[model samples]
Target: MKKMLVLMLTLTMVLAISACGGKAKESTTESTQQPTTKTEEAAATEEEFLPEPGAKLVVWSSGTEKVLVDEAAKAFKEKYGIDVEFQEVGPDKSIERMTTDGPAGVGADVFLAVHDRIGSAVQSGIILPNDYHEEETKANNSDKAIEALTIDNILYGYPNSVETTAVFYNKDLVPEAPKTWDDVIKFAKTFNDPKKQKYAYMWENGNGYWNFGFLGGYGAYVFGKDGSDPSDIGLNNEGGVEAMKFYQSLKNTVLPLKTADITSDIKKSLFTEGKLAMNVSGPWDTISLKEAVKNLGVMEYPTLPNGQPMKPFSGVKAFLVNANTKYPNAAKLFANLITSEEFQIKDFELLGNLPSNKKAAENDKIKNDPFASVFLKQFENSVPMPKIQQMNAFWSVHEATFTSIWNDGVDPKVALDDMVKKMQDSIASSK
Candidate 1:
């Protein structure tokens, strides 16, 4: 009986050992297989994930257009989860700040200002090219703006607002609008009461801005037909001289105003009081004139004395992204949204400025607006202001040179010769 009990015990011990072995093997297998499943899950998670939120962007805008810029930025933040820190700086300070602070990472991630500053901004190596504007987006953009931003086929910014010249007249003084420049001249002559008040037409006699539209209408241009080529300055050309002569003819017919003499306040005071028949100014002048005069009328620039339509130099205001921005994608997203139609029209309504987006201009809200449509149509006949750095130097000297010629009896040819020489010299010196 003792031997039989011993054999049963041995068999039970062996079965227990086998069961323990099988359980150990299963434990080992699970440890190895669990990690594989986790690895697959981690890869899938990465693939399915969306970009992280809570990105922030810093921006700066030229002052006084705050109403327009602010609303647009607000819309951008709402559409995309972003925080925009915006500052309003003077128009002249925008480039200075960017050039000094952008590369250091202390400046704006995006900059909203004029396109004329692009040449200097690009050369500074801080403002980046917007190489990805979709074909549809390009289709609706201002061609002049596109040209301004494009440097050797690379575009630097998308245009938002276009500043162009239009005729603003006192409805009380000129019951009928003039259709041609000759009519305007005739009208000015008839209305000449300079002894009592300033005569008919007035514009800042400083920058070539006052000349661009008139000269353009007469088949003359600052830089010939191809605007980018500076070598073909039409200053001495026959068409150009004729345009200058026409301007000179107006010398005795109207009250002369220099850039320094005619401040914004002074211009508005004269025009609103029905002291002047017509004046050339930009969209920025609209609000003040509307406030100053109860009845203000705006129209396309009248035809040139040569009977050609007046084509003004279009000025585009755009936002440029900082190449050094840590959040480039976010900055680009904000830029794209601001230029979108929905946001643009809202900007127009709230700010009383024209929108560059074609679809936005066509919206019922914008199309039906009597004031908006009138200025918007002027885009059809505008060209972008020069994007060269020399343009700044040119603007600085313009008032002195033009005033001397227009009012002080300085020879127009001599003034133009000196002007062209200085402009070319300025461009060379900048390089």
Candidate 2:
């Protein structure tokens, strides 16, 4: 199965550390020598880290971020005398698409992806570890970002940004953001109107991404040991069942609607129209929400019913080097260069993303911006989504399990236990 999957994902990956490597190592010899030739100078600087001579690389970038990639490509070409081609591929779809494209030799040499999907990329054997720049990467970026991109101890990503959801409320309806889930519940008493399609609070109900906060606050995790142990599932544990019970209870009292009826579009429309009082959304919604509502406020999420800090999953976006690339050295260099402090800041300025670079995160613009500030604070308590292949299956199971409990009256424990079993079955079958 492993071999078949690799064949499905990529044809061959030749990344010889001896052939094309990383930074110049610290020389211990006392004698000093001068490099005479251009090749010698390049080797002495990178020492073994030089890119393949005349190497050109292809980079897969999202259409929205193509300009940034173009900038990086231009800078790289000027510095190394190698050209780079920019190809449009949605960052979210890079991993799956590479599975077929990579083997055919048309895939990117470098690509951008969210940290959560690193495991699938690794298991498919289509990407190279960030072996060349690991040390400096850790020193320059946030530890959590580094941790998120590492799968089973291998550094697979060059960190770019940190993202997580936070509280967004209408200042007219909510004088102050709710400090607890109970606070949201209390406000619902006077605010809910089933016929008018108005509600005090609303979120994507069945979506595991948002709902995971409750499970986390109640002390349940998806898989044990930071998602490395597939055998130790935690969704059916005591905390998980309790979390779902509270999640189930909120159905009628707070929202007064079925999970399917509360789509994100409807919620956004209601919030903008001044009907919905509050919402749990990410930073991406900042501009749109601000345009519609005069008094929109953003803040860290309120504590859960159990009094635990909201643990929404923090997602780190990263640049990954493809293993199938002909020029591993050039690919790694390009990946590292694009995620440097300069580019990170540019990404923030142009895209409104929160940079993973420590210095970039400390910039006054991000610190002073209310919406960006909230997500940065919330990231302190947030957990990265599991970096395991099972997560690909876990999302569907989570949605199914939560939907059944919220809509069908299924018992939380029974539903969760079934969820665990389904996860195990899926993991086993995938193997």
Candidate 3:
């Protein structure tokens, strides 16, 4: 099934590219001829086609999301009489496997994916185009969450959860959350003790995903605001260089550790051990942090020195139906059921995931939760991570650029300029 879909997609692309070349005149003539009204009506009728019942369905999710998907599957089975199976598959591995399994007719009917993967999945023809519950989904989810799942103006998935990094502080060490970057720097200067392994704040500064907040806060962005224009790269601009300079200054000034020393494991260990006062992380750390720290407090990311809020990249996790699935209706139903407001609220209660559903987010339980509220506030200032395939090239370049500045002592401007050039080259090659 997936193989056929890929073949069709490849042929479509080939024809499109060819049409732009020597066949432009012929293709234009064919395209300009309007379809008959009867033909259009027939296409509309076919769009409403539904799959048969009693088809067994399989779903894949990460281990952390297993319980949520399992509960959803149970509810879906009861309501629709469709037998559903749930499997633990990490998001990255799921996308990778779909490239092979989908084409072979053995892929799960539904699978979880981060919003950023939508572009690649669509390009590969692995995920189906969603035409179910469009209005309900738009009305229920946050605009950014909805935007995340949209590729070239078509919805591809049902958003389940939305996440962005925020500041998590140890209440015992910091009486209150720092309000601004300068405040954080001052607090770090007074609180950090390299000799005692204590620090005021720490994050994986070398990681571009985490560092993007600072760059974005200062008017630097990976692409344009809409994230569609790859030619307008912003990472090496004046604001970006300034952000990098600030990031570089932290290594030996406010932060006692180097960028290479701030791996996620090390950061988690330090924070969990009460040696770190504050750490920038996402919801995935909530459970472990709560268990390790007696008094854990969450807050919106601090304001930058320029008085602008730190703009983290928001990532939406959604359920995507396999394009090649035999049970299209069942898969769509299951996807819709799992991302519904009720299930989103249940997921929040069970796993502390921040729901993409606006109604679920407005529930008293989530609205009143101190930890959850902070993330909600941060989301207001966050930017959706770009869904363009060019973004795939951006990640490695971002990492290398930051690593050079922080670890290799390369000049920030030089590193950024080189990084952007490399990124543009990569984007061209990817095309």
Candidate 4:
């Protein structure tokens, strides 16, 4: 899936003191001693910790946030006289590391990732609730952003980035961005020139994300339970069906050049080359879009015939701690430092990511940036991506089934039935 909602949990992954207690003591002692050579000590301290005496922390991140995480760690050490160690790892591996590899040794005291992983992370019983928000923090950020990262009424991560699916169009081809999905379809059917080298939109691989957005426009929801309850499935409901039908109707009209290959770069290239007039994308590609095309325009995915703007699932990336970390207090401080307005705002400006910190949004640096703010607005009505583990099972069969209906001449009813059955089977197998 192009934009499968990534869920990150606060790992607070402390190794069992018994398991690595010996190594930790040695590492701590070494971390405190000044090396004989100043340059060597400086470089080593730069990578390891520069604690005042013996303060130490470990962090795991996606590596994209390396600079930000590192700077924050450095600041924490300077301010509180603590030493911090950091590692780079993707969200999936982070989860595996926490659950299967953490307690033994070599695990992070805190983890940084997205919100969608909360269910599985919590189910794994290795994450702890966060208690860092001030009243001002909640007031500045969207309530939904806060709620999305929260599980079991306990917030486990400090939401760091805001993401949503919005319409990105070329101003050269279209006079103005359409206000609704119906308008989008109408525009595609009316203006697209297949024989001439233009398309109204591009179909990546499947319509899950697009359909998910449309379902919201029609007042529909998937998984029914806001990730807190993982057993429920909402894909078979009326809204889901309607959303699917809408996507099926667009098969030939305005899809991308490579309908079967849902790769993002390919889709962006088509749009940039003037083959695609519009597509749904997030802040991840804002910079590339601007560099690829001139006069790029953005608009909310308009409502279905029902008058609701497509409330796409917003992605929430956050910093989490490992529950098993030996340095729980230090880990909490580190998580707090990462989410602080200074580091988060700087990251938002540098990366074009919508800031998760409430105060970061108001920073003068990003207040007027069009690309950043558009994504920020999408968060207003955005729903959190469902964080169920069964979601993986559903996705495995989703593309094939969706392709069958939209491209391979399969009946919608039959296709949906197979999808439901396959998903149910996956759920059973997982249990």
Candidate 5:
């Protein structure tokens, strides 16, 4: 009976040991398998957001921009192991090409545009609003540059360069930059001799783009304050008529040169030859002015007689992404890369472009450039060009008003009132 009891106890102990071994093996297997599942999930989440490794991106560029764009493309491809192809298209012609190609899915993934064309592009639905790096881009770029590119309070593109007209003077001719319109008039009385083709200042005064500063300085505008409303035109307001009268007085009293006689080429030649003391021009004239004149200097537009600064129309150059791009994420990444601080600085170095990136504009090279620095100062008081579609009609009306006042010697108020009526009719017809 004792042997039977002892054998029963040993069998029970062996069964308990077997159960303990099975539990240990199960725990070991679960611990090993759990981490593998979690690791796979983490990797997949990372891969989901990353751009495809071998995607190809197409870019549209102008011949003048080829060098900078090519360098940027090579750098982008090296970083992402993607391929980039560039098509040489002029900046002015890009909008038309995109309009035809975007809907067909044959347009470039990215292209450059002027800010004034944003309204038209948005209306046409060719360009897409930037969705990536919004905060980073706004924080790094100039406020005005960003504001110029925004339509209906939404940013449309990445601003790369900023340009506006400033007063370029000959240091030897003027001795000092004029501080006010009155000073310019005072000097012009003695300096200007139309018979000799010598003048204190010369500009395309009949063109709306160049003459907008005069009207705008007196509170005239093509559209409403935000530039989004087309019905509210301010170009023929009380201040506008008064501003026109002032402009006519200058042409009649101080400057005898007519708009037809003083073309852009003539103005450039006069300034380069030291026949003109001061001229209103933008950064595009920098290279030629530097080579042609020995004592070239730049200053902000002279203040008007009514204690207002001459607020020239400003334009920003930006890159827009095509709405029909197959690789939206990759296209956005490339846009950000091209507008980066490094690339902006390189563009300034190579092309003499005024960078819209605040950090890039602050570089020692830009800071030391006399011409560039004056433009930066003038930008403070400059107004952005209207982005409304009605601006197309406003140009012709503006030229007529200027011609009637400056060329035909018509009364300023009468001409402005007629211009307003014609402009309203044009706008109504377009709609």
Candidate 6:
């Protein structure tokens, strides 16, 4: 822990030195301004936050909606005269790359990452806080987006979209979404035909993210209620073990393939072809699934066997400025711009993503959107993926553990205990 703190301090010093010139440049812009009215004062204020001289920026995002970035970049150039480039980078990999590529000055000026990874980014000191636009961001975006992007009291990301898993079903086959996992199982008994590549339900069954949907109760969680207490892992608790047993029971009754055979692509292909009835998926797949299947319907997660709403992981994808960027001001400007209500609306119109901005969510199109609305409802019951660096271990440990329990028929209690121990050790080593 001390070594981590030292690294954070060292990186902070480097960013501080690099950004010190920004205020001087702002002051230089301010001195030349002779403002006599509030309008001019506002204009000066906007102009005063200037980027470094001749600074250009590259932004990294998943590229599903590159057009959104392109539009934002166009407006950004109009305002700051800075050239902004959009680069394709998966949010998951982008979070990892910031650890190595960012400090080396080879990463994008601003990059998109899932909010859960904020802990790693902040602790590494490779990303700057959303200091300049924190107030605006908070007032515009949903509370969940704000909370997910914040650590301690500091906001670290410009909120873009919020997502959670939900059960998507073929309306033609099922008519209504399953009300509970039991409903899913009952339907599976009659609907499943492995020989015909058909099933009543499908999902990334063995994946930790999917299994996380089953864990919900007063005392069952990855770490603790807020997922912040590393010492109090609850994955081995009574509720968690029960959830795991039901999880395995579902697999035993429905799908006959090994865990590895249930790839996302295969599930998707089956679902689209009407070979599968219901599957748990997020909004990213909504568009293509709707396009491929005319009767596609999405609804918030069904109630679990434990009589609680399925608590899948909730994720917020937001943009963060690279602390090591040559153009901190420009990078921040782009992040702020793209996270605005209009930009978020564009994201929704183009990609069907749930806008984090409150006004964007209130847009007529989004409010009426069938698919987006269900995920929004699910977000209420969803678990906010922990924003601690130790969550990395949770993923590594549980991914294999869940698969082992499901595929190898390992005892749920024993598997969970071993998984918790491994996760604890990984977190301790990192500390």
**For candidate 6, lDDT tens digit of each residue in 1-431?**
99999999999999998788888898889877768786787677887787888999999988686888999999988987888888999898898998899989899999999988899899999999999878778989889889999998999999999998888889999987788778877888899898898998878877887778877632478867787888888989998888888778877776767788898899898888889998778888887888898988988777876677777888999999999999998888889999899999888888888999999998988988888888888888788899988899988877789888888989999999999899988988887
Tell me the TM-score of each prediction against the true structure. Answer: 0.80, 0.85, 0.86, 0.78, 0.82, 0.89
Clashes of each: 1, 0, 1, 22, 0, 0
lDDT of 2 by residue, 250-337 (tens): 9878976778887889888999998999887887678778889999998777788777887887798898988889999999998889
Candidate 5, poorest ten consecutive residues by summed lDDT = 42-51
How well does candidate 3 match the true structure in TM-score terms? 0.86
User: Of 1 and 5, which scores higher on TM-score?
Assistant: 5
Candidate 6 residue 170 C-alpha distance from true site, Å: 1.0
CA lDDT, every model vs. true structure: 0.72, 0.85, 0.86, 0.71, 0.84, 0.86
Give a tens-digit lDDT track for model 5, residues 357-429: 9989999999889989988888777788887767767765777778778999999879877887888899899
> Which one wins by TM-score: 4 or 6?
6
By TM-score rank, best first, the candidates go 6, 3, 2, 5, 1, 4
Work out how many backbone clashes candidate 6 has. 0
TM-score of predicted model 4?
0.78
* Residue-wise C-alpha lDDT for candidate 3, range 148-200, written one tens digit per residue: 88887898889999989998999999988889888889898888998988988
Q: Rate residue 143 of model 1 by lDDT.
A: 67
Supply the global lDDT for candidate 1: 0.72
Please list the residue runs of candidate 1 whose C-alpha ends up more than 4 Å from where it truly belongs after superposition.
1-54, 90-93, 132-136, 195-198, 368-370, 389-393
Candidate 1 C-alpha lDDT tens digits along 318-424: 77888888877777767766777776666666556677777777788778865566677886777676786556655766666677677777777787777778877
C-alpha RMSD for every candidate: 11.3, 14.7, 15.6, 17.6, 7.2, 14.2
Candidate 5 residues lying further than 4 Å off, grouped into runs, are 1-58, 81-90, 104-106
Q: Which candidate number has the best TM-score?
A: 6
Please, what are the lDDT tens digits per residue for candidate 4 over residues 278-336? 87788867777888888898777766666666777777777777887777667766776
